[model samples]
Structure formats: C-alpha cells, structure tokens
Target: MNHTTFETPVVSRARTVERLVAGQPTSDGAGVKLTRVLTNTLQRRLDPFLMLDAFGSDNPGDYIAGFPDHPHRGFETITYMIAGRMRHRDSAGHEGLLSNGGVQWMTAGRGVIHSELPEQEEGRMEGFQLWLNLPAKDKMRDPWYRDIPSGEIPEFTRDGVQVRVIAGASHGVPGAVQRDQTEPLYLDLHLEPGARFEQTLDPALNAFVYVYRGGLSIGDTAVPVQRMALLANGGDTQGIVLQAGEQPTRALLIAGRPLNEPIAQYGPFVMNTRDQLMQAVEDFQNGKLA
Candidate 1:
C-alpha cells in the first residue's frame, strides 16, 4: 500500500465541529423528487453551513414536478448540476440554465423569491442544492449572483484522479466565488480505480466527504455510495487522506469554519432570533421581500 501525506493547520479536538446525520425527506412538487438530507432545524444552526438536498429523476414523471416560487433569506443557495438541466428565475431579475458542471450561487441576504424548473434532457434530471448561512452581521446585506460554468472552475490531476475546485483553496488553486464571512472549501473529485488523494484542512473547521458516484475507504472506515462520512477534526496532528476503491469514484469534499449561534428557522427563512423569523414571515406575506 502506498501512503501519501497532506499538510494543514492543526488544532485540538476540543475545537472540532459537531456532526449530525439527517435522512432528508422525499418531497414531491414542481415535477421533482427531492431528498432533503440536511436542514436548519436538523443542523441546529447555520455556521458557514446549513443544508443539502439531492434531486434526481430519470423518469419524466418524477422530475417534472418542479419547484415554484419560494422565498429565502439570511443565506445563500448553491445549485450544482451533475445531470440534466435546471432553469432558474429569481426576484433579483437573475435567470439562467445550469447545465452539467454548471453552478448557480445566489445570496439571499435580505430576501428573494425564486423558482427552479427541470429542463428535460434525454429524459433525465439530477442535481444538488446546498444552503450556506451568513453571519448575523451580513445576514441582511445586499444580494448578488455568481453563475459559474464548468470550464471556468480550477482543476488539477494527481495519480489519475482529477479534482475540481468549487470553492476555497486546493492544490494551490482557489474558487472564484469569494465570501467575506465563511471560508468554505467545496470540491468535486473523480478518481480512477486504485487511485489515491489527500488534502489538508483547518483543524478548527468542520469537514466531511459525500460519496455520490463511487465508494472510498477513509482511514479504517469504508464509506459507501450515497452516504456522507463526517471526518474527525481539531487537535489531530495528522491531516486527512483518502484511498479510492475498486471502481472509479466521484465525491464531494466540503468544509467550513463553525458558527456557534442560536438558530430560529421557519420554512424558507433562517435567522438568529424568533422575532426575526416572525419578521421574515410577515415580509413574505406582505410582499416586502421573498
């Protein structure tokens, strides 16, 4: 067995972020079948992070149920396409199609109402939706949009494995979408059978790997497909490493600094206080925002 070592800032286990497991419910609407894996209530509070959902439908009937206009606040939503196409239109007057390897990163700082519809492609539609929370100081800030095409992202190859930098830093490369608050690392990796890769990370930040296309063995644990493996951080002297399995493997590695705060959430709105939640509801009802 060949071993590779990666270097990253070290910290004590006491600073490691907590991990929570959630089997997101399958909801049908707007012609799509969505499995909500993580959400505000289940994640406790947003700390440079919040939720993730996977929507997949090979049958037209399952994916045709699209999402209508919905409101969001105090966070950003990132939509990444792995298969099929998605058309997005938002209250900010932003609209576009996210094809395979495309991404839409939108900041719903104050509020925004948007709708996402599956654009049929060879009768299949599959994608991921991730939610990132902003700090209290930037929760009500101005909104912006980053429509990133696949080719525009940075990538590198190692030992027959290719890695794409979706956010943060890796292999001396960094993602384009910059944030003032949360320093996050989002990556898309593809490894050939028998390949291996390792990356360092901040010991104080929470980190995990989600297997979507293949399986991988981390440390002594074998993480299967469609499952997420939460890594142990903080106080550990050695960084993390991964070894690819028999078949080609594709996975997403994500990590971010922690945000320890009380979370008040209601449906599409997430805030720090209950009063803010009520205010968000009122805003949506009054047509002030959303």
Candidate 2:
C-alpha cells in the first residue's frame, strides 16, 4: 500500500489589497448590459486574465437579445451564473444550460463559434463571464468545454464563512473544474455579518477579488459591491484575510498563474504576435475557424 500526504504551509503574513477599480458600464453581444470590471485599459491585461464582465439585470429589456453567434480563438471563456439561466450552443454541436450556481468553461483553443441566450422571456438575469489567456504553445489545440452544475461544485463552511470552490482547492477540498495549462483558482465566498475569512494562495500567481454584495474590509480598506480589489503579489507571504461588515457579504476570489508572454488581441482573437493575429483573422474570414 502507498500513502500520499498533502500539506499547506502556514504563513502569518497577509497579502493586502493594493488597489480598487470601479466597474465600467458597458454593452456587448447584441446589446446586453454589463459592468466591465477588468479591461485592457486597467492594466494592459492582467497576465493570464484578460477581462471580467458582470451582467446582471432584472429588466428583460436590459438583456433580452442576449449574445448572438460569435467566434473566438486562443483563449477560454468562463460563465458562472448567480441567477436565472443561460442557454449556450456552440459550433462543435455542444449545448448547455447554465442555471443559478451553474458554470460553463469553454476553451477556444484553435477556434470556436458560440451563442448564449437567456432561457426565460421575462425576469432577472445575472452572471459573470471571464476571459483567460492561453499560452502560446496551447493556442492551436482542439477546443474543449466543461459544464458543471451547482450541486457538483464543492463547498466548505467554517466559522460563519462559506466558500464554494469553483476551479481550485479550498479548505483541502478541490474544485470540479480544473485546467492543466493555467491552473486557475476561482472561489465564491459568503460571509455572515461580522465574520472573517482567510486563505493562502500561490505567491507567483496574480490574484483579485470582486465584491458583489454587501461590504467587506480587506486589511483595513473597505470594499463594496461592484468594486474590484487587486491584490499585491504575495512575495514572501501568500495569504489573504477578509472581514465582512454589518451586513452579510458575497465576493469572488480568482487567481491564475502568469504566462508572462506577449499578447496580440483583435476583437475575439488573441494571439502571440501580429502574424498570428492576422492568421486568426484570415482563418475566420475563410470559415476555417468554427
């Protein structure tokens, strides 16, 4: 018999919130209203993470048309639903429904065309879409998709704090969605009033937190809904501590290993160089990109 043991080092130092950026109101994909939290203008791309968009609206007029067919390559798209439902159909003949608490991870390696539309005619629709950059070597790989339901996602609770592990380990429990290339961490945290949550992270990775509900204090700095806090590099220490205010709070913690490579982006195509970007354009124009 063989035995394996995993251990996480205890670090006393905590990573502090470096900066806060307010989300910008924007519209995209057949006129769906969204708040762009992270954009190229913010930091000229945050290593492996390209963009984060939060789409939430109770009025059907704000999101009725939904995202029409679009093509993408050399990256991945992650859709996590907090409310309502979205139906997705891709060129690879894959279809999925992302309901409240559901998630869809789509890897547009070489190319892919997809559409996301609301499942209901009227009501609330709310969710997030994140774009992750792929390494140059894996840019031309085959497309892949992973759809995970809310129940399948692992959750852990302790001391009035609950954490849903979406794409990495939390409290010794691993998430359902794992990608070998980027090795990202996505966590949804809910903190009861006056509760505190803490976690250790990889020092080499880039990390950020997005507050969606209530208020939280990140190392003495107060953060509210629709605001994003970018964390400083851990350096010698790789831990973060967050405390909830009087009201209950909800936030997302995301981190990813940095690729540290040149980026060339054009609309839906992201590549390593101008030539590659031009090739991607030609591929889509000739119908080679699906």
Candidate 3:
C-alpha cells in the first residue's frame, strides 16, 4: 500500500465554479453495450480516477446480455447501483449480488478475471462504474473485493439536503468503502429546491464535481447536467458553499491527493514505468497472473 503523506492542504474557500467543457461519448464492447459519459478518457478533467460509465436499460434484451469473463489488472473498478440488481463472479472465488444503492468495489491488483450480469428479470436498470488506478508499489498485491449493501451505507440529512457517503466523508460522515490511499473522497449528494449544503474538504486534494441529475449552483454559478465543475483549492478556508436551485438536484463530488507520478497506460493497465507495463502485459499473455 502507498504510505506517502498527502502534501496538499485543506480547502478553506472555493469560488462558484464554471462547468467542464462538453465531452463526447465512447463505446466499450462489454457484453452489455456501455457508454462512458464524464470520463478522463474523453475529458482529462480528473486524473487517477480515469473513467466513469453510466449504463442503463429497461429491456431485458439490453441488460440480459451481460459481460462475460474478462481480465483486469493494475487498477480498481467500483460499481454503484442506483436501480435493479447485478450478479458478480470473479476468479478469486468471489460471487455476490448488488442491488439498488449497493456497491461492488473490486481491486484487480496483480490480475483477476470477472463478469457482471443483471439479476433482475424486468424493469429499468441504472448504475455507474468508475475506474481508479493503483500506484506502482501496490500493483502486484493480492486482489480484493468489498461488497457494500445499501443499508450498510451511512445516510443523513443536513438542513434539507440528503447526503450519502459512499466512498468518502461529507457532513461529518465517512464512507464505508476503504482505499489504499486515504486522500480521496467520494460522495453522492441530493438536495431539495432552495436548500443550502456546505462541506469542508482538504485543499491539498484535487477535486471535481459532476452534475448527474439536476441543476445546481456553486456560490453563484449554475452547473448543468452531464458537465463537471472543478473546485478551487482553499488556502486557509474550510469548505465550499453549495446552493440548490429552485428544483431538486443531485451531484457527485470526488477528490483525491494527486499521485504526482508519471503515468504509463496501455488499455486497462496503468503503471509508473514502461518496463513495468510491458511485464504486466506479458504476465497477462502468459497466463501467469490472469
């Protein structure tokens, strides 16, 4: 595991932010067709966390054709379900079901083969899967998995806003999902119209907010859907002020201390050095780690 201390400071004050430029959608030929919305692959707004895929389908035909077994290494894949259910099976002898508001956090350290299939017979399905990179020292470690049930997550109301701590802290609540690095925070925040929500964050951390469901205002700026707003680091202040619009709004706020290391990536693997990346490819090809 990485043992480096975070060099950034806590954010004290942030400006009402502007929106991230529009990004194009790309296709991933997993068993079920997947489209990446606000991902680093398309928009390099967020590093370390590389991609975010929001997949959904109401017809059984769209979801029933699930992802078959595939190999992954050098990174983590976190799946958060908002609706329907999914069945996960991996080569590590791990299998489970993830329902609405549940999470499946898988660390493909050295390597792992896994598949994700829908378990619901009917109704619309919606969820998001995010890809996070592992540092060089921890890349070859043993694979691990965390299955967080919906009820296991912490939820609370501040003023009139509802906050869900999925993988980080918010409003004095921390997430249940554990990470090798302690510098990151992930939150799912929902707010009613005419509400105000404010939370403190480490200024040393790199942060970005993605507007997923509804319109929101950071200070005085309005953020629309499918766009990201980058937050300014606080020099001595404690947090940012969030003001909800007249209508309800939802957004994802993610922050992590920057790795500040060179990145060499090929396909699904990311490494600090090209030599290590080549060895990873060979290991996968020779079936030594797959």
Candidate 4:
C-alpha cells in the first residue's frame, strides 16, 4: 500500500474595510489647508490613534504661514514629509528639519511647546501629521523627540511594491522610530499598477489604511485618494491584503494595540480625566509646561 502525505493550506485573514471616510477640509496651524482623515467624529477615538491630517499644495498661499508656537501634552505627533521641507523647534531644545522623505516623531509626554515652519519660501509643501495617543501610565512620563532623515529610513521592495517602514516591521525589516508603549506599525507603501502587498499584524491591534494617491482594492472594495479605509477588528484574521489599480498607488498603513482606557482630551492635551485635562491647561498657562 502506498501512502501520500497531505499539506495544510495556509489561510490568510484579510480585514474587511468596515467603512470609507471621505476626508473633510479643515484649516489648522496658521491657515494650513488640510484634509482631516480621522477625527473625533470618527468613533470618538481609534484606540491608540487620535488624528491624521494630509496637507499638501503647490500654491504657497495655501501653506506658507505654517504652524508657529504651539503647545502639546500627553501624546505624540509624527510628521512625515513627502514633497517639501519643515523645520521643528521645541522648548526641549530639540530642533529638526524634515525634508522630502524625512520624518519627525515628537512625544509631548508631560508637556511641550513647539513651532513648525516651512524651510522654503516658494515651492510645494506636502506632508502628513499623525497623532498617536499615549496610555495614561505613560502620559506624564517625559518629553522626547526623534528626527529621522530620508536616508535613514528603511525601505523594502519586492516585486512591484515598495514599503517604507517608519515605526514598525515590514518584510522582516524594522523601522527607525520606536515606542515601547504603543508598539505601533506605520508603513508608507507604493505599488505599481496591478501590484499586490500583504502583511500579517498583531491580531489584537487596531488598523487602518489611508489612501493618498491613485486608487486601490482593499479586500474586494475599491478605495480612492483622500479617503480612509477603517479595518475591522482582526479577531481571527492574520493580516491585510491590498491591490493597486491600473495606476500607481500610495497609502499609509497603521496599526497599534488598543489601550481600552478612558480618554479626556481638550485642544492639544489628551489626558485620562477631566481634572487631568484641566491641569494640563493650567500647566501650560502657568508656563510650567516645557
């Protein structure tokens, strides 16, 4: 008698796009025109993530003034440049210049005052600012900053897909930015026409994809530019799969472990309780935040 060995088929868990969000126009940071992708209206908060803004314009009038003298606390801010340059200076004596393909990761734990201005006078200024929430335990830890140049960022290419890892691992390659609390996954992906990209993620983490250019197929649904695809809870799923349209496509894929704690936020401060929120305000007003 002859016996044959059988192989088990691998099952890929693809998170379904729960909803499609059309970015809304909003002016922030000294008359900067940007599209707000994830905001308070979108489910109060997305666990460890707070907000995402896509800002870009060839016209100088749209983004020249830039963000001057701002205060933040209890969270983190990530600025990734795509087309232009931005200079960041904070009260912690931290200064960074984020040019094309550069990144600035700022953690305003206790408190921080900073300013972000364009490094150029006339040209295209384009970038994305992502707000990541800090857990209550880490909220009052300490302020820190990480400046990553374009040349330092790790980029992985396979077939027709290119992935730039900023805060997590992709294709077994780790990113430059690191956070022990959140353990977030942030990837900038570009795909050629008809290309496909897939990666497994922590099943307990919340994830989403924001399309910035061209179109893509997430699962079976089609997503266009300036739109966000919120993923369902991983549950039994293993990973996410995406396919590009006829044209090239670009997007940001982010995921993080959910804190599952109460959130109290006011302006630039995000705390655990209303009293903490008020304290943050008082600290800033009393010039104690630095």
TM-score of 4: 0.94
**Runs in model 2 lying further than 4 Å from the true structure:** 1-11, 43-45
lDDT of 4: 0.87
Order of the predicted models by lDDT, top scorer first: 2, 4, 1, 3
lDDT of 1 by residue, 111-215 (tens): 989888877745768778888888888788887787888878777776777888788877566675766557888888899997877776767666777778778
| Per-residue error (Å), model 4, residue 111 | 0.3
RMSD for all candidates, in order, please.
4.4, 3.2, 5.2, 6.1
What residue runs in model 1 are displaced by over 4 Å at the alpha carbon? 1-22, 28-31, 39-42
Q: Scored by CA lDDT, what does every candidate get?
A: 0.75, 0.87, 0.74, 0.87
Q: Could you tell me which 10 consecutive residues in candidate 2 have the lowest summed lDDT? A: 1-10
> Tens digit of lDDT per residue, candidate 2, span 1-290?
11123234354787888899999999999999999999977434367999999999989999989999999999999999999988999998889999999999999999999999998988889989999999999999999998899988888677788888889776677787777767889999999999988788877778889999998998978988889999888578667888899999999999888888888899999999999999999999999976
On lDDT, the candidate that comes out on top is 2
- State, as a TM-score between 0 and 1, how close model 2 is to the true structure: 0.95
Error of 4 at 187 (Å): 0.4
Two-way lDDT contest, 3 vs 4, winner: 4
Provide the global lDDT of candidate 1 against the true structure.
0.75
- The parts of candidate 4 lying over 4 Å away from their true place are 1-11, 43-45
| Stretch of 10 with least lDDT, candidate 4 | 1-10
lDDT of 3 by residue, 9-51 (tens): 2344654464464445554535565567555553234556777
lDDT of 3: 0.74
Per-candidate TM-scores read 0.89, 0.95, 0.87, 0.94
